[model samples]
Target chain A: MELLKCETSDIENTEKYILKNGEKEIGYGYIKGVEINPIEIFIYENERSNGYGKLLFSKLLEIIKEKEAKLLTFDLPEEQYRMINIVAYSGGRYISIKNGVRRYILPIK
Target chain B: MNNTILKFLERHDFDLSLIKKKCDLGVKSSKDVNPIIAKYYIGKGEEQQRIYVADIVGYDYSYMNLDNSNIIDNMSYFYNENGDGYSTRSLSLLDIPTDEIVYRLMGSFTRDPMYLMEADKGKYVIDSNGLHRLHILKAHYLKELSELEEGDAIGHKILEDKYMVETMARKVDYLKTYSSFLFQQIARYYGCDFDIRPQYDDYGELTGKVTIELRGKNEKLVLNDKQFIKLLKDEIANFLNDNSISKKDKKHFIDFVGQTIEEYDSFKEYIKQNLQEIYNECFSDEVEVG
Candidate 1:
């Protein structure tokens, strides 16, 4: 698998990368919902739990750090099952969710 | 479910390799899970791990029982043995190793899909009604000591509790792809397929109820956040412009977001310094950004 991190100029609100296995596009995701790598990530369901999500998140962090981010944050939606557990278990605080979406912001300083 | 446990184990900083390595079991999940399972899988055979883990997991929900619960507990107020439900029968938690199911069960909360909701603090709703899922979920967990039987997919018996499956599907709103994803994930974990279709009686009479089958995973949803944001931004701008939200309300909304979000970012700081004033001066009546 290959990891490609786009530049900040290429960063949209929810920036992402194409996850490929050789010539095929297996999945696409990038860390978003925070200033740096805090919480948002996605790998196709068929490709989940295979260490891809974690690997992608880690790679995104490297790119962001190289771009001069001293800290990062994440705000995960509660219904995003895998991430909710991930953030909560990682000591992400539950600030609120009543405003429509739950928040678990992990500050990587 | 195994994946969730492995995730939980990793986050807790448990050493996954059990032998020669130190890994953050979740981030570095390649470690063999046998180390943790060994602590609970005290039995000798095929079902040993399954049954042993269930015992430990089942204990966490024990507090939901009246005998074990306090009078002030909200669970006590919601607990119902036989009442309005898909069925009073809850015979399995599938093969979910207990604790992980709790996390899965709580998935929709802390933010989740359409079927489950927190009606109030610590309360959950299905189809706008209360559901004591704890009783039902636990009622279905199988902790019996035995060997693996053929065709032994987990949640088979629970699926036999047709009312539960159908009821959940009935509440599902298909507009959100995540809802289907949730169904798929939950079912896949149980080694079952989940489906929703029109309900029919034994004689082929249309009951008008949505029927659900424990089967099949769907293709994953495409993530097009850039497109979604463009649409959402347009929608929000239109709403703000059409509604003529006053300068006061707009600033209040921005301030609310600022106060609520404690984490700081240079982007947010940039918005506050460069954009907030421009928005207040020019786009207060209409949200248009460059």
Candidate 2:
């Protein structure tokens, strides 16, 4: 239930979590520095298309705002259409697409 | 020209039976059959030449020559050729093997309008055989063959060599580690405890097989075939959903899943269908009770 920042020491733990929970690990976003933040919001295999992604993403937005980060970004290379729809519904801005990876950014007020 | 090669093949002490067997195993064309026969018939003298062509196409004995010399016209022929061909002449003036030359020829055939048409219509083995050649060529020849992008040529050469070793050689110990890794991943996903160690057979044949020993008490869930299928399907679905994989990868994954399901289902069905015969064959030592 704890929302903690992922550190260099947590690499193995994060990998294990990713493997265990599958796409649900997307909710655990990465914070790079004072200015940049990257968030991942996963749609679990069984729970896909059930509005859980949006709820988790909303929580991620709240976290980004709390962190006072300048730029917020996330990449959804797979399931682009579904991700795009979710991001658009959540009022996130579209960023550039490069190397088959789609990036979306939400500015913290 | 093909006839000439065929005649040469016949004249040599080539194992026609083996060649015929290879052809039957989807080798198909005369070009593929010839080199395999030639390798057995005339080893070392033509070894380098065979290696050169195999390095280009990414498979052994699955290609044939279209017999056109004009580079433009022959692009289709080269694209269509599925197996390896041997030529004493180095492909380039620098005396290097002609793997790159054939690779590019195969690549251009797929991209060019005329060649693509032929490939789409199945006029050639362009999809399975030519498509792979085209990929290797494009990867290596995005620029001129000389200005190859990183690992392009080397990658193609490796694929070619791997195929040759897989199909032609009596033993392929080199690929054991790679195959082991793949098998381990598959076994782990299936929730089966297995160990695969490499060892040679009595004839000194280098072979590798997984020794899957079921660990722990036989759980009821594992014993249920229907549950196993459901678990497999769920795991596959999760894997596909988790990875941001490409379209081509998805196709391959789906095909793999289908094949696995079919194999397991068929095996189970065979056991059920032949239960009485199998019981008689194995339990004949037991005292018969009328």
Candidate 3:
């Protein structure tokens, strides 16, 4: 897998990182705010179920650690069971489920 | 905290627990401090509870004037360990300066409403509710200023043309203050870069064609001024229509943008009536009438 870092030009403090496999973009995710607030990860419909989501997620976790962020948080739609599973497997703590979304947080270490 | 608001909260039997005494940067003037009172709906469906937060602004209603005189004067508030409202890390994350924020704050009135919350002895701070919007506005403001500066440095010959220079300088001066407000409403979702050049004919007279380069996530659009405005409006409308954004979020965005645009139009009208002479006075020495 190839890692491509996008620009941090946004004043909103949201940056995107892309994971590619031989020029075919597999997945992307956003790391938001200086606080390293809840992140959003997406695996293209055509690229799902192939473990790329997990691969992209692991890479993102490393980035959060490199940034020295205290925790990794996720606020995702409840229907995203696969993503919830990945977070659970990675030790994300259940925070709450509100307005059709599940919120979780994982300490950096 | 204002006495009237406090009495109202007391009369309503508002739980004191909802009010957090977190804004402690140490500025003791009451007028300088604007209290933040935010409402949150915790949980969902049957268990949902509505809570009004005083002093500490919640994330949803966190729109604050981060560069407000009260906040800037008490910058140390962001460095405190217990102050969860804002942190030094968050300020550094955006890497913006106090002066720049103050400049942006002048035009952020409608975009960021004042929230009143008294805590820690007449001390209060703005929260991050509309942080993303403020940052977007700041981004557009800074980006446009930088572009104008670039034109100043590169288009020397363009400025030498007295007639053309007069018009350009006036527009540049107008944009220095107001362009960001105008662009923020429509260009909020797009990444834009401008390339303004002094177009010249065979005889070397300036024709004044400025190029705007707009980059979206997957495409690059190059447009002149007229085309750029029309296309940008159309594209943003299409984005609002096609995207899966929640109705509440969409309405919030539209309402804020609509108000700011009105402010922008009124300011432009004011400048048209009052600032023309001032612009001429400021730029007269810089242009060569030959």
Candidate 4:
């Protein structure tokens, strides 16, 4: 699948998963609060394993820190153990469970 | 020609009356008589009056009279090169020849405070006298006046002014050095590599660009210009949620970001107007309709 980089506003129909090419969007990440380079990464099931999750998580971390983030945190679904593993491997620590979702943190220097 | 007789007359404090009487007897000049003429008497009595008469005659006979004295000597008694009056008592301190006494007196008189103040409001006091003292003090003690000449005084003034200019220039140089250090610290904090270039304008302003190079593939989020702008707007909105920033300050901050990215002013205004909406859409949970 061709990786299409578009603005958040350009992404149409949030609910409908539009499948095109061999690349399925594993997850979506968005910049969050302003404690410097903040980002929230969401992993989708289709792009799980195969190192895409790890690659995506690392990319998000690098981008956020370069954007001048002092801290980066994200929410991972409690059931997504693989995604949780990937987050943990990327220097993320379990912060707290909020509303049954596990929150993780990666402090950017 | 009887030196013994003249000496006997001087020892007894002979008046001009005695000198005139001795002169007819053919005893003319006396080194002894010269000393008596130079002697100062305090009270305005007959003895002092006699001394004055002898001085006038001695001056005339030796051609040291007011009109006939060397111009420098004539002027030296009334004024110095600095144009201050000379007291005979003051001249006794000099070790120079009798004729050169005028030169030494003028030098001392020129440095006198009364003359200096009347001449130029202490400009000479600071530039000439003060600098001389400062130089001597730097040398650990006062130097002899013989060692200091007119050329040295001018050089001292020039050196002082040069020192002042150098001190000021050094301070500016130090400030510029400190500013670059602070800039480096800030750039490192942002996780961006920056090369701080010298600022040319006044007020020591610095200008440079920050390069955010992604370290690994898929390891970071790279955004286009539009996405980056939108992300900035979201970040600003989040910051303002509980911040005490005024509306004007918020607008100014938006304008500042726009300027940083070289965007139009109108774009900043438009982004600021829609910041809240963008935040709500991006961050708020949506209700899924199947």
Best by DockQ: 3
- lDDT (Cα, tens digit) per residue for candidate 1, span B1-290: 13433343344343323311211111011012111111111111011011111211111122223232211122222432332222322213233443355545544332422222212111222321123453324332321112224465664443323212211111111111222232333333235554433233333232333333443544422323233223334534543454445555555444543442233242244334433542353435654422
Return the candidate ranking by lDDT, descending: 3, 1, 2, 4
**Residue A84, candidate 4: C-alpha displacement in angstroms:** 2.5
Best model per TM-score: 1
Candidate 3's TM-score reads 0.27
Model 4: residue A70 alpha-carbon error in angstroms: 1.0
- Deviation in Å, model 4, residue B202 alpha carbon: 36
**Which 10 consecutive residues of model 3 chain A have the lowest summed lDDT?**
A91-100
Indicate the residue-level lDDT of B42 in model 2. 11
Residue lDDT tens for model 2, B1-290? 23433332344333434433322222222123222121111111000112222223222222233332212222332322222221212122122123444533533333531111010011121211233343223222322332334568786565555333111111112122222323334445446653333222333222233222245645322112233334434544454455454545545544553343344343223323423332232234642221
Which digits, one per residue and each the tens of the lDDT, describe model 3 over residues B158-239?
2222111000000121221232233433345444433222223333222333233334344434444445445444554554
DockQ, Cα level, model 4: 0.00
Per residue, candidate 1 scores C-alpha lDDT tens digits across A48-83 of 544565566656666665665544444443345455
- State candidate 3's DockQ: 0.05
Cα-based lDDT at residue B178, candidate 1 = 21
TM-score-superior candidate, 1 or 2: 1
Clashes of 3: 9
- Candidate 1 residue A68 C-alpha distance from true site, Å: 5.4
DockQ rank order: 3, 2, 1, 4
Candidate RMSDs in order: 25.1, 22.2, 22.4, 41.0
For the candidates in turn, chain A alone yields TM-scores of 0.61, 0.58, 0.81, 0.58
Q: Evaluated with lDDT, which candidate comes out highest?
A: 3
Interface RMSD of each: 22.8, 26.6, 22.2, 45.5
> Residue A93: error of model 2 in Å?
1.9
